[model samples]
Target: MSDHELRKAAHDLDVTVWVGKGGIDPVVDEASDQLKERDLIKVKFLRAARAGTSVEALTEELAERTNATVIETRGNTGVLHR
Candidate 1:
């Protein structure tokens, strides 16, 4: 789907994964598993997780680790597609 369409669909998805101070490693497995079951998944990054990094950066890193495509990053949330 187009980015716009993906974003629209993602808007309604509840965050199925969360990244905390431990960062991407802790959630990579869960995100990857969820993507196997769902076309789109939303992830929320906590303030501790953000640390010195931006949401987009974390989102991109997580997407890369999970082998998923980043749909978008907004606020501290991001959507991923496999």
Candidate 2:
């Protein structure tokens, strides 16, 4: 789907994965698995997860590990698509 369409779709998606103090390591597997079952998934980065990183950076890292693309990021939430 187009970026715009993906963003629109993501607007209504509830966050299916969350990153907290454990950071991306703990959620990488889950994110990859979710991508296998769905075209897109929403992830929320809790404050603890963003202490030293920007959401964009964290999103890119997670997407790389999961073989997904970043649809968009708003505040602390990001949408990923495979």
Candidate 3:
């Protein structure tokens, strides 16, 4: 998705975003449940900046780990599939 799309989604659905690392499993589990009901999830990454992980790698890693579709990246903000 493009920045415009991301912004529209954020504005339309009232997305919730946050930062964390090494806790992707539980997060995905809970998010999966939420997705079943609502179909959207957005998680902003902070670990990559703090821990020196490349944004592309971090996005790929998280997408692989969570089996989520990477919907968009606008700067450091990442939008994920539900």
Candidate 4:
């Protein structure tokens, strides 16, 4: 799908993964596993996980680790696609 289509598709997706104080480390495996089962997944970065980092940065790092692309990020939520 195109970026616009991905964004539109992500609009209705419920957050399936959450990053908290533990940050991305704890969720990398889960995100990768989910990507294996689905084309896209939504992730929410809690306030604790945002400390000293922007959602874009966090999303990039998580995507890199999971071998996924960042479909989009709104507020603290991000959508990822493999």
Candidate 5:
């Protein structure tokens, strides 16, 4: 899909995965699983997870770890797709 279409689709998606103090390590499997079950999944990076990191950094890392692509990062939330 095009970037515009993906962004529009992501607008209605709720955050299905949350990265907290435990960070991306714990959510890697869960996010990957969610992606396998659906075309798109949204993730929120809480303040604890963002300590010394930016949302773009965290989401990019998570996407790499989960073998997904970051559709976008808005505020502390990110949309991911495989």
Candidate 6:
């Protein structure tokens, strides 16, 4: 999806879902499951994630597991799609 669509969906989601620090594999799976129930998934950053982790790193990790699209990240919050 395009960045505009991602941003709009994130705002529409309203309710935030925490993916926690399950690493990228489980988080990606969780995101996918959420997408099955909801067309878009908002992945909120949790305290479990190390400060060393970068958004780029997280995006690449998820890309390998699912077809979810990285929509946006405003502060600790982010949006994704399946």
Q: Rate the local accuracy (lDDT) of all candidates.
A: 0.94, 0.96, 0.58, 0.95, 0.94, 0.65
Pitting candidate 1 against candidate 6, the one with the higher lDDT is 1
Question: Per-residue lDDT tens digits of candidate 5, residues 10-81?
Answer: 999999999999999999999999999998999999999999999999999999998899999999999998
Angstrom error at residue 2, model 2: 0.9
Residue 42's lDDT in candidate 4? 99
TM-score of every model versus the real structure: 0.96, 0.97, 0.58, 0.97, 0.97, 0.70
- The reply for model 5, stretches above 4 Å from the true place, is none
* Residue-wise C-alpha lDDT for candidate 3, range 1-82, written one tens digit per residue: 5656755775455445444655354455655565556545666666634277655666566666666666666555566665
Candidate 3 positional error at 81, Å = 2.0
Report the C-alpha displacement of residue 24, candidate 5, in angstroms: 0.4
Candidate 4, residue 76: the lDDT equals: 94
Model 6 misses residue 50 by how many Å?
A: 3.1
Off by over 4 Å in 1: none
- State the lDDT of candidate 6 residue by residue for 1-82, as single tens digits: 5768667757967644564676565566666677778767766666676357876566545644667666666666666666
Clashes of 2: 0
- Write down the lDDT that model 3 would get: 0.58
| lDDT comparing candidate 2 with the true structure | 0.96
Q: Residue 60 in candidate 5 has what lDDT?
A: 96
Clash statistics: count for each candidate: 0, 0, 0, 0, 0, 0
The lDDT of model 6 is: 0.65
The parts of candidate 4 lying over 4 Å away from their true place are none
What TM-score does model 4 achieve against the real structure? 0.97
